[model samples]
Target chain A: MTSPAITVDRLTKRFGAVTAVDDLSFTVAPGRVTGFLGPNGSGKTTTLRMLLGLMQPTSGQAIVGERAYRDIRRPAQLVGAALEASSFHPGRTGLGHLRTLAPQVGVKDARCHEVLELVGLSGAKKRRVGGYSMGMRQRLGLATALLGDPSIIILDEPANGLDPQGIAWLRGLLRALAADGRTVLVSSHVLAEVQQSVDDVVVIGGGRLIHASTLLEFEELASRDVVVRTTDYQAVETLVRERGWSFDAQLDHHVVHDVAAAEIGAALFAAGLEVHQLADHGADLEAVFLRLTESSDAPTTQFTGSASAAPAAPPAPAAPPVDGTVAPPPPPAPPTTGGVA
Target chain B: MIAALVAEYRKFFSTRLWWILAIVMVAYLAFIAGVFGFSLTVDTGADAQASNFLSPKEIAQSIYALTSPIGYVFPLIIGSLAVTSEFRHKTVTGSLLVEPRRSMLVVAKLVSSIPMGLAYGVLATVTVVAAGAPVLELVGDGAFLGDGDVIETLVLSVVVMALWTMMGVAFGTVLTNQVAAIVVVLAFTQLIEPIARVALGAFDATSEVSKYLPGAAADALLGSSFFSSFGGEGGGTDLLPQWGGAIVMVTYILVLAVVGRLTTFRRDIG
Candidate 1:
């Protein structure tokens, strides 16, 4: 069966006086990967934990399909999640961990092998989890999460510890899983990885929802990205930062976003620097996310999109400061499309 | 609930902790029972003779008794770890994820713990007998295993040990922290309860209460205990009947589970 939509309705969670999640709500649609994006300490994990019923919301509800998670009948058969990659018991073998979860979801023990192979851990199935690397443990965690073949899969930082090739593989895998009509919500602080994978995004900061939008809106914002390579790389970087526009550093030079390419060329030519590779590689979700999260020029608010309506972009950089500090963003998008290098 | 139970059982097999501790328990108890048996038979020096735990004849009747109580510690650790390990390893997230209903999860752990405890109890029971019987034959005057009472005592000892295990799991479920649960289990089962029984028995008024303690009840249910022999102001004649003690032990397990279901187990897992 395909996954049903996940809806969060004014979910508020307070640990003592500190609210980890404040009156937040959003919908995660089936047949697409929804990126649960936030900076560190943004309450992403806390919210996910609440959704899975690992933690209780101080008020309100997170619903899976028609009912709350706790009220969901045969929940194991409907939802699967890996809230953290380190959830596997250290002494258990990879296969053993899945076996432990299989019967709970009413899946057969043989499914253990099926998932072990699916996650590429069949060879190391017998090896104790303690000996596995971070990447291997992540795979085992994924294996366990998928043990039941649930319709909705939630993974927090699923690409963490994976090498670049593995990250690429994960990108395809998540898309593939979503293509199968399952609801997949993947949480990550690193925007670069998630942007390529997710179809929709729900961003939160300071325990409140900042924006809910599709990936293309973010990509459209990113398409305005301009890269500049000059003799004096440092000079262009300082110029971009001084203008208050975000920039990401790279091996050759830097990629600057939000500002026009004409503005960048004008600044560099006026500075009398040798320009080599000033190109438009388009902005990614990373650029859009920083604009939405980092700029704390206003108080926070949430915007959820309709089924057919486009996502309303929040103020660039943030509804509020992610940490009340507009730290620098990640390096500019890799020159993947047309490059002038 | 049954699915939860099956998951809990699978969890026991998945982790190496259970079986590793089980083997360690069996080996240690077997070695100790054999040593106790050999030492009791010969007229050792004053210190060794003073340490003589049971007569060879007593050893034959309670062949499973000597090291059986010590082996209770393993099952207690197992039962407690069953709950605490989930938190320690962060598998509690996965567990609750797989089974969202906390009450059913608690029930499953409770139901599954009995059989797991029995698994530990059975291994220890078998080891106690396997290691003790031959030593009893070499040292005791009577033929070992001659009476039906020996088998009954062995069976009761295993049952009581299993009960202790379930109790440990209850403590674990309620405590939530692994180290805290271990400390309490050891301190209470190994020291506090035993010492409390002896300390409280000093007062006639409190002596009646001591008999109702888990340790005292366990002794009563098993029909014999080393501590109960100190009958004056330091021991109890006030303990309930064997069946009553069993009921009291079950009550303790039930109270912990019900209280946990109401509080700790229902709290946020992460």
Candidate 2:
């Protein structure tokens, strides 16, 4: 990859009375796909425009590698971008459009054909873009960005109009590009597709960053919890209350968090209560994303991106090992950076 | 800036718009030349106002009028459409993305207009030769073809047409709205400016400043026009000399281009 990272530091953009992006900071690390996720009108497009130098930021800057975007010589070659699907003239063919931009980055004519082939638009190279479907226009946008063989690719809603098969193709293409050690940042409002396509995610809402962390870490935070069953649930609840641990008391079992299952079991057995079942509960990314974004108006809602436990804060400290007894519970899963607020 | 220039050329030529407009322009110029030639060829009565004493000079001067009305407007459209179409089509987004520097892109667009003007100039020149020469011959103005003054008039028209095209580019850049720019250009050059010239000639007060108007200055550079005779003598007499008129046309381009560049920075193309 030509650049090691793209750092958007303290970026803010305001249009008259409305603030589009507000003091947002994030790093798109090289050799991985970082999904830029936000609800509609959350300033995702505005932030990308600033990164591409298409708009002036109200404050701060976006830097690719070592230099600011404007300072980079041959930016088209070093950092490829498709800011919008309909940015090309309709009368021009897909090939014609790419050919027009190919020279700006010193790309040869034949390479324009090569990019057309790469994006699967070789057959429609001579056809006017007005005749192409939205899916085809997206492909053409990709081809134009790829014409320079740029090491950094920034795509905005690349999968908006793609068919199921096309999305799968894009999934593979993005993986391949990232695997080639290039920095890839793709933005999308469609959270499901991003969850599948990206290795890392930067979630924003209401013009502020909600979270920035590895996808695996995000999913782990969303899913980390336990369910326990006991003959005397009253006794277990009594112990949980005494220890000030977190748990949801259900009709049969208790959904517990912030304390390990073994600790719950130890506390229960110490009270002479018999433990029948204990299991971890799993929550998907969709549930976590919904809970975080939907709580925009209701600050009282418990589920929040900012309220998420930080990675450095241990949810439960491990208890000392007992002699010739059940081992002390392993610490609750280590919190990775990000979540709620 | 050079890369942006290349990209602009590619943008114009890569589409069917340039070639399509060019073909139509060529046909229109040919038709105009044919009509003008045919008119000179067959007029049973040469002059109705005066006795039948139409000179070769009058006919030659009549041909020069086509240089302003027919020639200036077409090249102006070419320049205006090339810049304005980008806004209409929302293709300005891509142009800015590649270059990023607004001034560089604006300057390149203005520079590209020169070649467009040159192309139209050559076509109009060829039309004058193919159609005007033979007709002028039939009218016993064969000497008009070889006349240094006539040749200089044609050359000046070509140069002036290029300047007008640059003005069209400036207008398009400043107004980004395609229909608005076209309307403003047509009204100012054809309707407003010409009508104002007529009003100036009628009244004694505004006649001096009317000669400085863009269309009048362009006419002044052409040296002779049917309007010079039809509109009366004082209108032509008060107009700037050929060189001064050319300067006025260039000033219009500079003013509009600077305005466009300033506003472009503030425009957030979403």
Candidate 3:
């Protein structure tokens, strides 16, 4: 159990009458790319700002390494953060912007150029930031964060405004950073945006911790629903009910929950039900993320065995059922879950 | 501290505003000085009337010290924009990320403004001299650049510019909004303070207080100004002695800086 690189313990921040971050707590382990996942306006940015000491927390602690971010003597060399893409001065050239930060970060001008090239901004290094496209700005931001070559890197929405190819490039860069044993925490409002790069996830919604676990564990949370198109909807519904599987009945199809397509097909065949079409509709992680975040009433749960560190349960009464069939109550409208290839 | 200062200097120089403002300051001071040099030296057949009030040497001294009365606003604006521009463009976020100690950041901004103010001061002084010297030598008493009082006034003009620049930084720290700071600075320096000083000085009771106003104190610090000499005899207001003016300016800067640190500077940056 190596010491966590970042520890957020019961951190809370309130902006006057509104609480931006509730008593949220999570940790990112070293040597992995952890996705700080949340929907927009869910206190993700607030939490990250608190972690970086840019904003003071109302209560609790956001600790990095052995001390608070401000307490660190040379924080830039230890923790590199690019919290937003718009923080750059529009009139400054990309290299000039990094050069301004270089002396303060205790990095040389040569290191600034290195990070520029690392982020593939060498060609545009001399261009003013105002003229750079949004994607280019994000890359320059990544370049700024990498200037100090810190062991810990935190970026908020690094994929925003990026083309697919650029996002792919970012994904590779994040993975390579993690492979170098750096604790990389990249945040996004969408799960699929960071799905392939993240090894662990710390999810928050409504400013409260919703789930925290390895990517595999989070992926498993996506309820696999089997949609069976059958000639007799009534019989298919009856078969699903007899099997004790929850399902939503559509006009000509029955979307079965918690049962695999293979098992449902076998059950229907044994019953001599004419199944015109039986397909597995695997819910992508993004849909699961939307479900969890969209339903703010979803119970706050931690799956990393550190639930004891989390504050008392939120007001939500229904805990995820022990069977893990459905984490939250089914949405008001059944989600048309599709596989994310 | 060194890194913070270096960062601040870099931030100041990396923008176009500094040079643009410097150019404007040069042009502005040169124009004002030229006007004063011409108006004072030009024999309008009212020479008898003007000489009875101010000596040729005094008129020459007034032109040299014109840097404070007319050109101080540039350093103030430059100083202020140093802090306010960060807030305007949201670059303060990056600044704080590099140096999280907010007080240190503010102090760096204050210290960094000195060189900038001095540069503007030198430029303003040079412009005034260039524009005023030829006219004064040709028409009025010789360009009294070598006079003890004129040299002191010239040097103090530069110092006064630096001080005003620091004041601008403090003012910007308090306001934090770039437009509001600039508007307040322009209004107070160009309109509000001057008018208020004249109005306040019309009364015997308020005349002493008027001398301590920022503009008055700056004039007193320089030891001479066209406005101060214009109303020297009949004008009831008397600016504080040079030392008194220095104290007043320093007090204003310190108080503003402290107040800014306690209020806006301490607030969490979003």
Fraction of true contacts retained by every candidate, in order, equals 0.88, 0.61, 0.68
Candidate 2 per-residue lDDT, tens place, A45-99, comes to: 9999888887889998999877777677778788888877888788998888887
**lDDT for each residue of candidate 1 in A231-326, tens digit (9 for 90 to 100):** 787887777777888888999878786678888888888878889987876665575566556431123222211113234333233221223224
Q: What DockQ do the predictions score, one after another?
A: 0.68, 0.55, 0.72
Q: Is 1 or 3 the stronger prediction by TM-score?
A: 3
TM-score of chain B of 2: 0.87
Error of 1 at B42 (Å): 4.2
CAPRI class of candidate 2: medium
Candidate 2 scores an fnat of 0.61
DockQ of candidate 1 (2 decimals): 0.68
Chain A TM-scores of all predicted models: 0.75, 0.74, 0.79
Q: Least accurate stretch of 10 residues (summed lDDT) in model 2 chain A?
A: A313-322
Best by DockQ: 3
Error of 3 at A225 (Å): 4.3
Provide TM-scores for the models.
0.83, 0.83, 0.89
Better of 1 and 3 by DockQ: 3
